[model samples]
Target: MNESKHNTQFLGLLGQSSTFISAFSVAQVCLTWYVFSFTGSAVAVGLVAILETLAALLVSLPVGTLVDRLNKGMLLAVSGVAGFAVFLILSFNVLFFSFDMAAVLMLAVVWGASREITRSAGLSALPDVVTSGTIAKSNGIYRALRSSLESISNALAGGLIVALGVLSGFLFSAGAYLASALFAAFILLPFLKSKTATHPSGQEKKPSMLEDLKEGFRWLVARKGFFLLTVSATFFNFFMDMIITYYVIYVAVGINATSLVYGLILSALAAGDVSGSLIGGRLNLLKYSGKINVVLFGGIPGLCILAMGIVPGIYTAILFTFIVGLCFGISVNVWLTTAHNIVPPNMRGRYFAIDGALSSISPVAIAAGAAVIALYGIMVDFIISGILMVLFTFVFASMRSLWKLDGRVHKERPANEAT
Candidate 1:
């Protein structure tokens, strides 16, 4: 009975999460593909990404503050509506005009900002719905499900584009986003309707937005483990950003892959991520904390990256990349769950924002990495990045004092205690 109830609640949350993610993933993939096809320049794609990241960086702190101070459900709902509006404007702009790249970039930037806000608010609201004891597994399941849905959605978008055309694909994506907004609006149906079991108290007299943001900053800085972890993880994030921005281009140029192949590779990565997320959730990470499991587990990806570079054939590389994806899925879910465990609930949004700001701005790194790859070679970048990520995992895991949150006062109270 307990398991059945857990499944029911989780599935309900998944319904809302999957819908938003499906729309976001599909629209983003279609828009990016449309731009790349039109321009035929990886640099152009990188520039648009840079603009979007810039928007996210600027808006992240303010959005985090809002998520901390305001009603999280309303904040999420407003962001969804804003995202729908942004997509509608983009669709109209492309439909009527000759498709100006500058204008399109602006729209994408706006969309990125909305996406950042929505994500921060939604994540901050999650603890209110689920207990900390289950947070790790819950996060793993959420990551896995979201990745799988995104994979399917991107594949569908590719098929739609091929059958109809880029214009129709954009329109379809826009409609899906609008539908997502409508779903998000239902979040206002009241506590009786949604009925979350976990709710942190003292939110009614929450601090001002600025104070909230400051509190988060202080929490991170005052904690030794968190500060070190954040600094170390930045390098890993930088490399991952470079990979996300350039992997499509790598396949297109190096492997001479078509749109279908691109979509397939993406799907493979997402598949790996899905598997990883599911497994990570079920794993006994606590049993092996500060052990070699952290680094050795992540070694799965490092080895996969090496295999991909040396594999020779596109099919073989795809298989290797899928394995790499699974490792990435595990690495991200585990790290996030671990961080959430260590950080206070009120500070999660701020720490997530800082993570977002660091990870989100990789377009500049993307551009630089691309240049370096072109000048030197893609294999070199892959090897160097994979090694660095593995190294960081080890270094971070060894920070024993920081890992325990010695400075911060979580009070170790029961979950039933009021905030």
Candidate 2:
């Protein structure tokens, strides 16, 4: 009975991610197209993207605290329910009325809030339900399937949008959110919170939110060289956001690609994600060459971005996008797995929240970047992004802590192999 219950919870957990993400992925493509078509300005696109993510940056720190204080499972369910409301309302507005930018921006806040709630809670909730032996396999499966779903969704989104209109995609997103919420609602995981967990010294008194927030930062810095590396990691997100925000503009304004071509490129990117996850997980090579793997995965993608800018052909752009996705797949799988092992379960929520908050700052940086691209052009913007990405990646690799930490980590493993 216990094993059966665990299986149900595990599946529920996967369902929460698989359903919401896939739906959102499809909706994302449709929404981007809608916004670009409506405004025809890259800056406006950036503004919309900024609004969508702004909530995550603002609330992540507190979310770290709340995740520790409250029931994670309940929080996720509530967030999913909130997502249901956000999208459902938007769907109705689009179908019955018209596409109001003000309404879209306002509803985006609620959508982002819902997304923020699930970001850390889902990962932190994993250990309680999944046995230690299977956590690694489960995570790989989760990522691979998530990427696969994104590929399928992106591939279909354009055809679906043309066939059924963007409004239908919004409705599909609403349904998917509801389904995910229901799945999370029934997941019976004992991923409970403990007050004594705030500090390493086992203090009986409960810590304030400020204290919890500080502990997260304190722990991140304490982990060898992760503190500096953490800051460097932000550079990746900064550039990544710039790319995502601008790509839609470039495709629409610069190349005049049709919706079909746009969807194909996005699908290629996701297909690479699927390939990277599968190929990267095939061996424990990353465990030995952690820094190298991370660098290659990250740096090479920047080069791809550069090539796309220089060449700017449809086929080349699709090829480069796929490489970018492939690299992301390998790097993400490696780093997330490493983090799961390195960080303690008690601190996972806070730590992930802090990391998320830092990474979420990408939107702000990309806003400034958008200004530069406005002055120059899209091709030049890609060239600059590629150069800076590579430079920062190597700078991140230069940190001593990563090397020492990797050495210590591999040394601690019995067989020096990632299970």
Candidate 3:
């Protein structure tokens, strides 16, 4: 196919994938609320979060290898199908049988695994879809669209949960996953057929899974600055997860807000994300990425969180959270764009998987955060998290090598043009 046609098909597939992801994101919000409401225990919510992260951790390496060896389109489809099946079962059980925490935890495992696979496939497939020059723009647009949809979905889901109850939310999520699966199977698979076939024939020797994983890790280790950046991000993620795990609880239980109010606060965050992503998509990241990262990642978010904690009212908290999301949206675009430009296309899957696993230490963080909340109270936990976040960012930014990452990365052959 011609380049324009190929790009069109790729964008179309990505759009569909984003739509499915937005729905899944909404489902996650609903599930979080449901779990907390049903159990009324911060520890229970923390356990659910931990279990989900553990599932992702267990499959990270294998999923990375599979993303490289298998058809990415098929991987995406399988992920959606798995999600659909699990949620459908959950919905049925919720409607017909008792509310089983065990079943919910089991489904969390499956859902988490599927989410990791889908994310890996998408990251690995990006280079095949767009030119190196447009990676940042494409990623930004994708994130913006996803955030916009998520905002709407979250707003709607809050009302849905209140109006129709939690079971209906699960049913809607099941349908969303089914639609995602259908889109991947029918739309994306056709375009990827040729790409998949280009791999070695059945008779050709393929590296062992262990070797493939080793190669991925080696590639990552060779990039010292990027590796360190990932480490810093992992730390950042650790604290961020703690805050997220208890955010709903803090707003609903601590601050005494309704479910609808909580959803609106979340929606405000997503709205800010949408705005930042749109702006990020259009900026010349090659020129100003460093400044953007220093401000957005290193400075703004921590301040926002700190302000949110100190502020007295829900509206003030929402405003601060919105600012945090805006910074996060821009920072994430810069980070992903830089990574995509530097990493070899063939190794993106493994790179992303390893990075994900490192960042996915949320389970441990959540457990810790839960304990802290139980002892120190939510307000104190937020203050500590914010302070640590600021300290980590300062330490990371003090590294001269990290500040020069964008310049050094531009010197390399871009990933999309690698092979």
Candidate 4:
């Protein structure tokens, strides 16, 4: 593709996805902070995460199948609409009806379902929008923006809660979601719909749900790198679950942090994530070289944890968290790009869906592990999660030799060259 075309597509994706993802991250941080403030329990915060992931899992199978058969753009728009409604309802209840935990949980489920569909569709639609060569940069830019947005939202959310109160914060979150829906419909969806809508003549009929599921599984099994990448992602998911579900809460309890301080810590980590992701974009780190780095050196986060666990101070903890966040951002950009590159364009949705479903199961394990942490404390959990990550890093680094798999399995062909 020409430079002009590439830039246009990149800008379009940036506009729509940035708005939705920023708003989504803002809402999530606000909700989590609110829940933590209200309940004063780490387990409660963990439960919210558990519920969200469970809801995503429940909706993932059908949504994944539907994306493969339908226009992914339409699906993304519908997801935006659903998300808009959810935020509106939550806003109304929180602003007027007394913001109860039950009401919040209900909205969380709605948000979770919308998140599952939108994420799956957004990922699948990428190949329709950008040339293969730019896909890694695309992933990098998306993740970078997402991380930055989340951090900015966290920073603003802390002040929003202080100045306007929780109700106003929730309402503001609703407005952001509404804007996201509008941007998605007018900008991103139209671009994608034009490319992905038609069924090719003599194309086989859409497969049944079971058949689709089986086909996705068969495809994954046949592709060794893709399969290992997914498996590594599962372990990665567990480590992240620890960070998101337990780390902040640990900070709050261990350090007796104020709400603003907690927000600051989160924003700090997000800032690291943003930087890492953008660097990834410039480096094209989603390529094979970047992924190999994950296997060889990803133990940096483990070392960070070892320091945090031994020192156990707020400043040290925050620094450790930030380092981990940076490493995670790099790891995620490489992981997403590698996996997406492996799948056929048409099967991208199903591939990501199955990936989501498989990854979803890890949260259950994470929640169980959280319970253990609650009893045994984070010292144990931190050491164990860190060690596991280090081990997985080595395993992933050795995968090429062990599995006899080449990284460039699904090279992205230029759009003009498409037959």
Candidate 5:
């Protein structure tokens, strides 16, 4: 495939992905508001999150294997269709019937499964659609566009819910998923086929699914730096979840903010994400990725959250959260691009899934955070989470092996040997 054709097709896929993700964000916001309205407790929100994470965790390994074996475009289309169906059903129920917690929990499980499948498949398919040299830029573009759309959708969601009710949000969510399915089928699948045709085949026996799973684990274990990075990320997710699980509640109850304010705060964060992703793409951070990771991922985000805890004002908290989003946006692009540079195409799906599962440490963290909020209050939990995040940065940064690691140096090796 020519570079122009690859870029066009990749952009099409990304556009559809961005649209669906934006819609999902809107639906999520509406659902969160509904849950909070009904239960009036942060613990209920935490429980919902835990259920979703548990469902994703259950399917991660199997979905990883499927993503590697199946056609990536087809897998993404299926995921979209599943999301559309689920949301459509939810919309109908919400319109005609009363809100049912049990039904919502079941839908969350299905929704979470579909989300994980699509995300893994999309990330795994990126290398197949773009040249290696352009991976970081392409990833940055995708993130920037997605974040931009999310900002718009989240801002719209608050008004839509207030004016037209939650059913409208669910309808929009269903429509977006349907569009994603159509786009994948019509635009991405054909290009993927052409791309595959251009590659020269080698006669090698395919591994069993179990073998593939084991290989992914072994690859991560062999690369000490990457393994440690994953571990550090797991802890980061744990601490971050403590804050995120109750972020909206904190704004609503703690700071006495309204739904519009909640939406505006999220929009600010997404705007910052867009800025960071674009900037990160322009910088050459591969050589110093290790140090960059420690600062952007841990140092900046920790400080931002710490400031939020101390200030505890809506305006200041929004500024701090936006900065946190900006830093993480850059860190995410760098980390993902580095992974693409090192991981082989054949193993990327499983590798990403396993890494994703590791980071799905939200369930326990949400439970603990909710308990703390119940006991002491949101401020105490925020302060504790911020402290832990800052402390972990030093721990991650102190590793001499990780600091000396360079992604560009590793990129030269064959993927198998690089691990």
Candidate 6:
């Protein structure tokens, strides 16, 4: 009965999360499209995306701390409701009031903050919503399915905006949030929903926010293996995002591919990723140990990068991009699975917040990458980047810290000690 209840709650949580991400993706596209259509400025479009993200990152620490201090399930619902309110206000501002860029930007910030709340709360709540045995699968399905949904949502966004109008677009996103809130409120469990943050054992006073944040930092640093994994994760996110940021220029200018061909290439990448995520979710990727699995998947992407740069035709480029996506996608899901299982429930929100903060600075890498492309050419950039990635990634298979994360080393230790 307990398993059945957890499964039921997981389904509801999935519904709530899917709608949240799908709506945000589509709404962002619509919002950016409207700004571009009216202003005819690429900078304005970029601003919309950047500001929203910036707002979220600015609030990440506080949001994560708040998530830890509250009932995570209820917080998720609150996030949904808050998102709904933001979209509705934006809709009214655009539809009735005069359209002001400042107003739009302000609301975007609000939406981003609300979205971050959901993110932190959801990550913290996920472990409790499903059995430990399904943690890997749940994490994979949650992310991969959301990615697939976002892709589809963005694909149809332009058509929807054209046919339905931008006001309708805002309302549509608002409706998604409303639906999400309903699912969260009615179907999601309130398990661990209260402020249960523990201080030092036998202490009466709760920690201050700074103390809580400091403790989260302490928690990560105290575990050397996990700290290494966190650094590895940050490096992967930085490098991978840099690749994505520059990939378009390579296709559009370097190869001079048509928009249709480019679209197909992206589709292929997405397909490979979704498929690989499903595969990773189902298998015990640690069978060869996490170290070997990480090295294999991580290094394969480097080879794919080399192939993508060296391959002559658009078709060949697409194939290698697909391979890169597949390998990287698997590595990502495996790490999420492993991390989800390892993080203490009380620390998940703060841990992920710190992780996210590390990722937020990744845009700096694009500047370095851009300099390389400008001076060395995109092909040279790819070659150098791929070689470095391979040299470093082909580097992880023997990291005993990873082996111990899953107890492979611990099991051997017991046997050796017994002998």
Q: What is each predicted model's overall lDDT from 0 to 1? A: 0.66, 0.74, 0.78, 0.70, 0.81, 0.69
Cα lDDT tens digits for candidate 3, 283-351: 866555555665587467777777677764688878988898898888778877877777766677888
Global fold similarity of model 6 (TM-score): 0.78
Candidates ranked by TM-score: 5, 3, 2, 4, 1, 6
Angstrom error of the Cα, residue 207, model 6: value is 0.7
Worst 10 residues of 5 by lDDT: 194-203
- The residue pairs that clash in candidate 6, if any, are 71-193
Strongest candidate by TM-score: 5
Regions more than 4 Å wrong, model 3: 1-6, 197-204, 287-291, 407-419
- Per-residue lDDT of candidate 6, residues 1-419 (tens digit): 33523587788888888899777866776676677567754345445555676787898898778777776767778888888898899888887887688888888788877888888878777777787767777877877777677656655565576577778778888999888888878877454544345557788887887898998887777666656666665665555544555554566567986434544565566667777787777777744435634564557777777776676468788788778767756766776776676566777889888777766654455555666776777776677667766776645545666544551212112211211
In terms of lDDT, the best-performing candidate is: 5
Q: How accurate is candidate 2 locally (lDDT)?
A: 0.74
Off by over 4 Å in 5: 1-6, 193-206, 409-419
TM-score to true structure, per model: 0.84, 0.90, 0.93, 0.88, 0.94, 0.78
Residue 372 lDDT (model 3) = 88
Candidate 2 colliding pairs, count: 0
Error of 2 at 300 (Å): 0.8
lDDT of 1 at 1: 30
Tell me the lDDT of candidate 5: 0.81
| Residue pairs whose backbone atoms clash in candidate 5 | none
lDDT of 3: 0.78
TM-score of 4: 0.88
Which pairs, if any, clash in model 3?
A: none
Model 3: worst 10 consecutive residues (lDDT sum):
410-419
